[model samples]
Target: MHVQLGVLGPVAAWDARGGVVGLRGPMHRAVLARLVVARRRVVPVTRLVEDLWEEPPADAVSAIRTFVAALRRALEPDRPPRARPRLLVTEGPGYALKAAEDSVDAWRFEHAVRAAGELPPAEAVRRLTEALSWWRGPAYADVPEAPWVRSERSRLIDVECRAVEGRAEAYLSLGASAEAVPALDAYVSEHPWRENAWHLLALALYRSGRQTDALSVVRRARRTLSDQVGIEPGPRLRRLETDLLRQADHLDPGPGGPAAQVWAQATAAYERAVPSDTRTRLESTAGLMRDLAVTGGGGLEAARRHRVAAVAAAEQLGDPEVTARVIGIYDVPAVWTRCDDEEQARWLVAAAERTLRTLPPDGHDAARCRLLATIAVESRGALPTDRPASGGQARALQAAGQAEQLARRLDDTSLLAFALNGVFMQSFQRAGLSPRRDAIGAETIAVAQRGGLVTYEVLGHLVRLQSRCAVSDFAGADRHAAAADRLAERYDLPLVTVFTTWYRALRTAMTQPPADAAAAYRQADAILDGAGMPGLRHGLLPLAELSVRLRHGLVPALDAQDDWGPYESWVRPLLLVEAGDTQAARDALRDIASPPRDLMFEAMWCLVARAATMTGDRDVMRRAATQLRPAAAELAGAQSGLLTFGPVAHHLQGLTAAGW
Candidate 1:
């Protein structure tokens, strides 16, 4: 029998000719995500169901078979070489997909990452060059309902920084200094905190015979790192600087690879935003200009060049709110050249508050709404919810409504599209049905269809909303996720695409073994990487920490800085305990115990369950469980994005494995 496998980018099946195929119904998408992540290995039918339906129906087994059958047909559509290697396989108590390491996106990504690390300079460049070609955008952008697949996408994204570093290094090693500069610069621009890219960049410059320029680069990099995030360069980069100071090398270098395409895309975006002063053009340019304002070290001088053009464009655009919004993206990490987080915060707050106060009573209102929303989100902790003076939640809604109203008035698709996205974000903080969010999210799926809006931002909000609807009131998180995934794919926005899909798959996947969760984590990590938000970018802290604790024993340290310190301690230990390390979990629980603070209650109960599970201690675990039960109940209701409930419920089960 022909079997179809999907462990990379959706459960895909094709004949020898590479034609698109279909799969069976019910949980096909969920099953496809699993196969892609698992990469054709035999995943138990039970596991497939769990990855699909969180609380599965009695007919789950049949559902799995139906999905498998659909996959086979999809892969076997016009089989000539027979579907054996063309699709998936049925084996043991589960199914085995036939695609090899190179066939799946996950496998392809791992292969690329590995090749980049293992290959020599020339070959490394060659291998990575081949690898990057695989990313059309976010992995499996068309299929967004699978947690298993989505997690894999996140992992792929996390490696993006590393991959860029590796590629640039390879290019430099091959004496392609000038060619490597733009990519390295882009890397530095995106991750202000990461030092490796900076180090590589300085080296590229120094070797390229810009000794004076090289020294300046190092100084600027050092200043930015020190000022923001409160740390200095790690040892490795410092060593590179010492090397640069003493070094002398020939500067002849070759041209860039296809990453030129990316620079092209960014350039095109810049070009699109320029040559116009109308609100239509200005609104379009706003995000791109914000992109330009960022700083990357060398290559395209991406952030610098773009920011200059953006500034000029913003001036021409001349709407206060638009100016403020563009300025906000620039201001958040503002550094005319070097990064200054303190300065960034200063500008962000000033621009945000100023924009809020000066919002025109009757101007490009959609642009104004977007500006306000961006400010609130970017300056998140700085402006607490309890204090709404700086146009917090309530103001955001009013702004969104007004923006939508203006869009309707002007019949502007772009403005309306932006307004709709703002509505989605505003509703997350506020309650009730919002016309802007609802009309656009469900109604205008096609409008935001292929990255007409920012995919990551939209997915981040929509995922939460979808989960809210599925578990609390609405039908499912999948609809929002499904649309988001398509956009992520089209735009190559990884994590945002996955956020909507991960938790929905988790409902089913969570019931499986601890290893399954690890697999799930890997899948989720891939997409989260592409989301490009620092918070989502750094989310691995919790998932990985907990997964390890669950799978292995937690080794305590005399020092507080062991890999676990930076994370929320309560949450990690709970996942670990639930993963089955009850004793070690208890130790962590004892250490984490603090009287319940406002936000810590949810996290506190997680630890409590773990400790209680180890000793079969009822009182504390029960209390934590009872207190957490409502939250956990809420999670069971959740169908997508970062749910507190799944992990909480899992911990509760750890406390008392009986009911589970």
Candidate 2:
């Protein structure tokens, strides 16, 4: 597809046939121009808003979203309603534009100029001329006088200046002294203190048989340098003056002169031979890492090793596109999960964000990676049982929404499903069992199926199962659980199978025989063995549910390990209380931190209170009642249909009424 966006002249988009694309309106054009100037790096929403609005509107975000949507349609007229966009995309809290480096005139110009530096004089002159021809009048000529546009305009002008100087050098190298003279003269007139421009001008004049003119040019440079910055001309200029004075035939172009420098660079490039199997080895490394992620116990560690090697290979090859792909591995989150604490999680998130910032703005890998990183960061706050709703969680949801919009434009259903998973997880955390959750689950399932992503398909079904279970729809939950089980087995995803088995156990625990539920829990444990709990969230629910229902002996017997730190810690007390070991249960609960108004703390305190009452521990009972009362009140007010509600609140109420 020969898609070209012209910001060098008017802000215009064109197809291969040279037909103009309707950017919709002036506002839309401005937005496209702004994104193009960013050269594929993400532009934050706040920056865009500032550019699009002088005073800023109350509904700035809605208006920008509308403008970007229209611009997207204009850019890709043939795209279906939700097709992945090729030109423009949302990244994090902002938007980015994507096109071939040669398709955008400014990028084409910069690349050409850079390439010209290593070429012979004739080729360099031709390339520079072609690059300069891309400019019409000014950079983003049609855009209004916004700060972003002006800033980019200044940068482009500097690039233009560099191109002009390069062109002069190429002309001088080719013995076109007359042509070089005028070009350098014009350039120096505009950028008076550019020492290279003056030096080139002097060299051109001297070569044109005007030694006196060349000497005068050096004098002018000395004055300009002294006046502007209170410094004399540097070593190059001083050396040039000495050569001109001697009128030496051995001008020699000096050390590191343009012609000599170009030849040296070309020589170095030729000598820097890469290993024959470098690309193959990099691919092998990435493939092995991916293999370990799926089949080996190393999980994300293998993936991380692959990322480092892949990125190194890409950097060696000087391919940003390859670097992005290497970093965008779906297993990126596995690293975040392995973080031992929230601080570590936050550090990982910050690092991921930095990496995402460096990725090409609208790159598929970058967009997918941003979504994954956002989801990982947000996961810290959206754990099913966390209290006080993490401050970063809302920001994560917003980022996921942006990623979803971009994924749809890119026509990437897997990324769309992953992004939607983040949205659903956030919504579940906030509202629990709402119609929104049902709708999100259904939509994600459809996306996964359409995308033919079995992993996501399993995840989508699991979400539906969770939502159904939240509403106590055991039959519906069972159906979804069965679907998940079949998909997990078919896909050979042991983790998915474990989740499904755990869900089945939770469903049967409250309704069926204890033995049947214990068997199901045991199946999940056998699948998990002792590995893959990177954090509190991964295996918490299954362990908590099993410990809550079964006796202490049964809890340990279900797993291979007798010492399951946090997992055993949370459930062991409940088992002790149930087994009538009240003192032991009380001792077990002592280390469990009961933060005020926390749901987990309240739930645990209810059990502690009940055990205290049975053991005639009045002091412990009074403290538990005091802690449970406010926590229960808070939970009642913020009751989500997501988890088992009323148990803690009912315990607190029962205790209060009994005058404990």
Candidate 3:
């Protein structure tokens, strides 16, 4: 049977059937509470005796034994005579309470706080909110204020403060600053000594457009810290105050205000009564707004609804151009290594194919080219099982090639740039393709500049940045990153910083210590999450951090048995080596097939090289070195636009030194 204990409020216990255990009198409750606070650790009788009373009677030990017997009878009424207690057991010279952590409200609250620390902001808010709910009143309220009880109560209060501040921080991170204000107001009033709470409250108020109130809060915090703690405000609070005074753009909630207005206008236009052709165009424009909304931290479900409506309207209109526009709405550069939305991609691919069938083969070459390019872009990251006999990559490349050929025949610069982007998306499927991608990026920039396409210009720079990073050309990468940032800022692009921020973090992870690298990755992830680009960084950040730790000879705190998709096959072998299971690591490495010549090939090879080195598998080392030699100048895994495994040169040197 299960047991439930509560210390977040008054000390209490309930059995499996929801009946109170009838802990009688102040002394009885105190004894049960003391055992509960021990958290299943043995507390010696002598310590309990001292904690329970300042003065002891001659029969105090017998009195404690009587209390224990009465508590056991009340807690376990079904136990047979002389049977041992399951929840409370005597161990050595003390008694221990053996309740599960989840059964105790205080323990569960602490667990949630710890778990919230590892999660993204939105999830962290939910976890911390639920944990805070477990506190009904003051902790251990019914117990007498013994020293141990007082200490435990103080610790719980500290944890509660952290949970409150953590929730507010998460809300701020998610741009729900207004929602965080009321709670933080109450929290700061109750716990004025917490500088972080004061900072968050002030920031939340400022973000909610209460600048005067925010300034007052900061000033009040300065006074409170000076008077209460005899110190100045911390660096973060000081910086926040300066930024507030200057009205820094970074202090603004998000850059979504303008995008939100555009979205509203497009949405209104699409819903009006209009001609079929105009309506189709309006629907397509609305679809673009939906994409903007998603990239600007708006809800995903609304974007999906807009997409579906636009696709249906275009198809019903029977206009191939409108259909193509709706199908190719995702105009960003295709840099994702994994398929984010399979259903959406499949739908767009099928729509493009159907529209192509409707157009005459000889004429409408531009429409055909656009449709072919859409197919190429949407066909990215498709699994082999989803392809026909020609294979997914082959099919995508064929479409891209045909589109580029048609664009050149038409002598249209914009169309050619679009077609080249399709080709780049398909061509970037494998490692050692960085040189090819670099050439493509260069041509894209030239063509976009000739046509004055700002969006495409930014994309061109981003592509070059990614390719340069892959090749470990940090100087060249920085140039392209600067170029892209300039264009993105001038054009007011909403989510361009997501890619740039990730690249910066990836570069840091390659060059910095593991802890610093992890922090950089986390900062980048927060930006990505706040931009509503979860699919771009999903599962990749943690793996990136793990790779950094592993490279530094530190064992990562990850479950090796957990499935990591394509990363599982290689990571498992490396994890085995970390576990000191040389034979197991060797066997796992042997079972791994030749690394597929895909985006992850070099990264997987680097992991295999490390495992091989640790296991002294000279044959595997030789194979890994041979496979990784072509990309020796590249950072392994950076080509995937996600993460990196430092440099391929490092792995090659390791392989050579390991007798490869």
Candidate 4:
């Protein structure tokens, strides 16, 4: 008589005729579960007795033997009396279930999962789906609670989750993103802490052209992680959020066509082959370059590796245009406030400069224009300081100006849009320049619209939104924000919504109570955090919270490790005063130099004024008032990109009331 065993759901056996075997009692089933948990290894009679009872009875050893005898009879019903048990054999001092792994459902499921890894995505999906079907409910559901049974059940459940995820991933690899979405959504709902499920669901949503929904899913993931897991989402999920926002083409489903198939095959062949010829090397490098231009194609770190290989190949080819093309692929979005990857930025700048030298000095062609624009953007991050008209900013502005000029002369709309981006980046370095930046933004929007540059157009709207916020034109800012969001959703550009969300939060803070505003900021911060945009909010969130609290005469518990960057010195005195160090706060206020004429000047001065008021430093308060008086109508800190304090008018009123 053939026997089939199962530990996947309940501990049970079926005879070859498909009849359920009736084990004598609960203890019999528990013994079978414990042995199956051991995976055919011997479970000593003494150990079985100890596990089955909290305190074994005097005849516990005999009881275990009796249970095993009943299990053996149920497993092989036709066995003759006094014949040795084939399925459940008694060995020296122990028992082992001598069943083939294929006869046990859990073992067969695990084997199928292992084998699926080596198969094609379609085959893997089929194998895993079948493997997953083996699970009817919790493993060993009918067995008594034993330590070994619990551990094995937990392991089986985890493996079942993996199989579900594996099948979903296989569906995704087969370009069935829409099909993957429902399963992933259900999986994440059941296992909310599974970051990979969230990542795949967001990707599937984005690929299905639900860009806004994809971003919402990411935000939900962030909140779920923070609330339930007490940790941020991992880098892969964050990277996926970033990629979704940018509408990276690679995140879209793979194309279908004869030409696309041929190209895919070529790329695969190039990846597999050694670069023995220049053509092969060029093809390989070009493929890598394309991957480097976006996230989600093995992520930013992998793309950086691709950049290295592409640059080497381009340099070897010794073609200035090719070299410039390889070096100037800046589709990866950068933080405008600071350099995230200084080494890579510097390499780009150096490579562009070298490529420019190879071209004729007097040439005013597209390649030269593009190379200069590349230097302009990369130099902002590559340079050591943020000082204007010198160092990085100066070089960046000069190159951008040249690029813009050449682009106009050539009448290349796309080139003009590209050059204007550089112009906007460098020009945004200083405060009181929002008017100029606004004009640049307008011109970019016009140029981009004419050239059908959807991404640049969205960028222009964001630029305008920031400028409007800086100038305290909330009405205008609202219009720009709406426009940007509309374009973002329409074009599947999710990243644009991140900035607009921050602007909305800031706008909310301007009108709502502090707590309400704080909640909005937290929401925005969650979205920013989900997108892995730490640079944009470095010290901004905490500073905003502190400023709002101080405005309401509330003291904040500040952390010293918060990276306030250049604003640290200006904001330190306020923190000190709040901590009851009035004398130290006054001293710190006295030591501060005139506010740097950068984007945060008015905001930083307001912080100084607030601190001065708290410490009764009339002189410092008067100095801040005199400087901020001209911009009394503007919002403090709004010009600082992703953060804002309240109105300068309000701060100035406080300074006056404090007798400054």
Candidate 5:
């Protein structure tokens, strides 16, 4: 009797434990998305007809009646055939989804967001994140584009942004200014016309001690607003600029009294004339390092300086315990946030490993060093599709295995969760799905929750989210995504925040129409670029898939260097096909290499087969169909990652079945 209808992404329903309630087809799902958005009010039959069909047939009303009847059966299977429906009750002119308010994720999200403003900072963040998590993708993603759907999508996006603003403001109030920067920067970049986002970005930068950057933000806002709209800065923004010029004390968090108190204890322990107790100094330095780690990542250069100072202090003390703790606490954010910087991560890991050699192999300090180095190696090889043959992945798995053993000996749940996360990320690179991946994710979540570790809990949710998306359970993915957002914000995990935005863009492209999908992609990419992270190759793949799927030229502008690769190469022909050069697209495919050993190849090959069919290249069409068969077969039977592959495989099979 557990019912959950989700319209934030694809129109889907799920039981309490994530079992999907089949709505039979896109038409039925579309009807449900519309009804859920109506919030129990009846959508008139004429309006439903216009929403469902661009050009209705003579029997459009009759067709809708059939869809509704089937949907009622799907929603309440035990209901008698002739009995009045409870969930999809017939109203005066049309139908309504008369379920409880909380049974619909969209309604629950709206209620949570509306309630967030009156709550405390912590509670506001929690509520806002919960509201956001219900959004799997674009509003009514699987539905065909029509006036009503488009209008509702716009309203939902505006509400979603409100939740984002609330979360960012909450983080700023809690001194998590660095975590607020990427989300606000991306928002203002996408919506330069919105002066409120500009103000928020400036405040975040100034609070993070980047006064010059804050000034640059206001300047950009004034220029853009003036040049585009022919208006001066808004009064609120002008006042903020004036405050920035005067170095207003209220702009930043008050000086950290707790940090200063910790520093005082460290200094007292170190300044004694007699030889200081080694353990006391080590503990004091660790405390000081913890505070710095919390406060440091507000800016990259600032974080680097703090890390350098800590490394020097650890080396001078030459205490493996202190050095291991220093490496463990300091290096994670540096590696996690700076996605483009692998060499620095490797250097930190090597330094930690060298320190480990000076300690006993089975000691706690050595185990801590092992855990640090393992995660760094995993980060260095995190993007498997970007470089398939790199030895870094093999080394990463070896390190993860080693770390897992160490974590067991230390009896540390957080360390064990991270060690397992590494394994889970790398294991799925060459295959579609596996039970072990789910087990790893569940165990990671369990261990992390028992230890009260928010960071590991975020990682666990990501694993579940990725696995769910891989199999195409958009509704289940939405559920996990909400938890990820809440935890990442609570702990101020910037990299996790980046991942959530990217995942959102990916879902948007998968579910929404091309134009809407492109805008979402641009927003997520801007967030990544503003954070100084390297471009994600996978992030661009969705737009390419859409261009091919929709038979239109909707490609994002790519640099010349992005013209080749397993991912980009497939995308190249898609652009050509969109530009009305099907012949050139076929020729381009001739020179490109066969797809790599991955299920994403199924998506690429399906598009290739469709493109070949369109260009009348029977030979290429046959070859692509041949190459796609095993991939489609394996994915068709695959239970875990079925969602990712199912849509593409079906399309390819349908095209092939239609004859070259």
Candidate 6:
């Protein structure tokens, strides 16, 4: 329990008595090394076995267990001369080291990394400078080759990249771009494929008045990646390059930064290339590639090329709906670069309109029909509040209705299955917690089952919506929970695949208070642990926020800056839990409601308002009732089965009087 964990230098662990744990055995030690590197979590025994031996020996599990037992004994060394909990524990289905994470070196490194993100520029530099000092050599340096090692090595590189990025950011913040040169250069060199890294380096160089140097650095990076990966620099990165080149004076930030104009040109070019209507290999590939470029970590030029190709294919194939959906997808990146919000909205709405124009009177494919539905949903929901654009909500409503009609009429199983999902959205909007709404949701399930298209991505969405409904109506979300479990089991879906869906479901079950719902959460947490994605990890924030309060009996305050709040708050559906602080929760509701709209935000306000009043706050109770009256009214439509954990809705409900 008191072992000196060292992730700063070759990952060391020392016993309480100060003896070095000899992680020195040959292959067995290698297995231990992999486990240690991945500490506090399971490293699939099979994966470890694969690493220790190219072809695992016949008794691989037995051998792996033996190594684990040995590592545990060596690392733990019974401090009290009794069977104290070993340093490692058999967690879930895999072996895990239950080291008090703070005692581990990797945790120390992580602390440094985290501290940098929190501190002022000077403090960040100090923190990261210390963290970077912990790296003695490439991590797992002596660990023998193993399957887990490949992934672990990649993780180590990622950690290093973060440190570099942090240091560079801190330097930029402090007006010390010159100091960041070496770090950025080194990082860019090591991670030639990283667009974000390239962007920071360019920013550093340009900010330091090295315009030519900045431009040259980006050009070099693009060329290097091209030679290495057979791809051009990514769109975001290429935009940065153009930014560097277009600057009249690098020191003076010049002329409508290139991201918008270049992206527009790229987009318009693609749009011009393609025709309308129909899906093909080229069209799907192009859309997927551009989506990846927009939301993914891929090459920009390549994404542009794919977009152009998609456009050409769409035009050649002449599918109006395909062109529309592809354009709708483009709307996101367009806005990111400060493109006109109205312009993006116009393009999105246009897609739906065109889809409507071409959608067959009774087509079974449902591609255009579905796209029309999604466009309606996102466009209406995403409309910037600064200027309330007209017709988005109307279009969304119309599209939803039209899609419903088409889905219901199309009897083909696959198309019906797809169309049923659209109907679920439309019907959910029309009648919350009503039998009709639940029936539509159920039908979606039936269609999915009938079609045999119950991928977790599909099922997760369905279950999440159903779980929401279950919460709204105060019904057990168990059926939907069961459905999720079956889907996961049937497909072997990775934890992340259905993680948010499961999280929302569990949170809803917890809304009842003191009752742990199901063992599903353990499985859900396991999925998140393996995800290694920042955004996905953000989903755990609410659960973390709630679980810590319930377990510790800590009085939650109204302040938004809890330890986990920063990590999770930015995601959505604002939550206002009363950690014995009903006043704080009330205040929190006001904050959540005050910020913005989008169904997700409004939903959170409703929930927070509900919680605040329950804990005390009569005025909050009255206000909540006032706010929730309409919410309840709205709920009858879009949200049929009250999904309790839709934090925004809860906030709004909390604000309303129960009868209101």
Among the numbered candidates, top TM-score falls to: 3
lDDT of 4 by residue, 399-491 (tens): 989999989999998888888887876774444677887898899899989989877787788778777888878899889889988987786
Give the alpha carbon lDDT tens digit for every residue of 126-220 in model 6. Answer: 76787787777777766655567767777877887898888887777666778888877887776887877888888888887788888888888
lDDT of each residue in 241-311, candidate 2, tens digit only: 99999997755453247766586566457446544456644654565565545432234333545555565
Listed per model in order, the count of residue pairs whose N, CA or C atoms clash below 3 Å is 39, 7, 0, 2, 5, 64
Q: RMSD (Cα, Å) of candidate 6?
A: 20.3
TM-score, per-candidate, Cα-based? 0.42, 0.43, 0.58, 0.58, 0.47, 0.42
The stretch of ten residues in a row with the least summed lDDT in candidate 3 is 381-390
Off by over 4 Å in 6: 1-280, 284-368, 377-391, 426-436, 456-461, 464-476, 495-526, 529-540, 547-554, 557-603, 606-623, 627-660
RMSD of each: 22.9, 24.1, 11.4, 20.0, 20.2, 20.3
Q: After superposition, how far is residue 452 of candidate 6 from its true place, in Å?
A: 3.3
State each model's CA lDDT, in order.
0.52, 0.62, 0.77, 0.75, 0.64, 0.53
lDDT of 1: 0.52
Model 5: residues >4 Å from true position, as ranges? 1-325, 330-339, 348-390, 489-497, 505-511, 535-570, 573-648, 651-660
- Stronger candidate by lDDT (4 vs 5): 4
User: How many times do residue backbones clash in model 4?
Assistant: 2
Q: Cα miss at 308, model 5 (Å)?
A: 6.8
- Tell me the TM-score of model 3: 0.58
After superposition, the stretches of candidate 3 with alpha carbons farther than 4 Å from their true spots are: 1-294, 299-305, 316-322, 383-390, 560-566, 582-599, 612-626, 640-642, 650-660
Residue 378, candidate 3: how far off, in angstroms? 1.7
The residue pairs found clashing in candidate 5 are 133-482, 471-641, 471-642, 471-643, 472-643
Off by over 4 Å in 4: 1-164, 167-305, 316-319, 331-335, 362-364, 381-387, 560-569, 583-601, 612-632, 649-660
Model 2 off-target regions past 4 Å?
Answer: 1-292, 296-322, 331-348, 360-395, 409-411, 428-436, 530-564, 567-660
Native-to-model Cα distance after best TM-score fit, residue 487 in candidate 6, in Å = 3.3
What range of 10 consecutive residues in model 5 has the weakest lDDT sum? Answer: 636-645
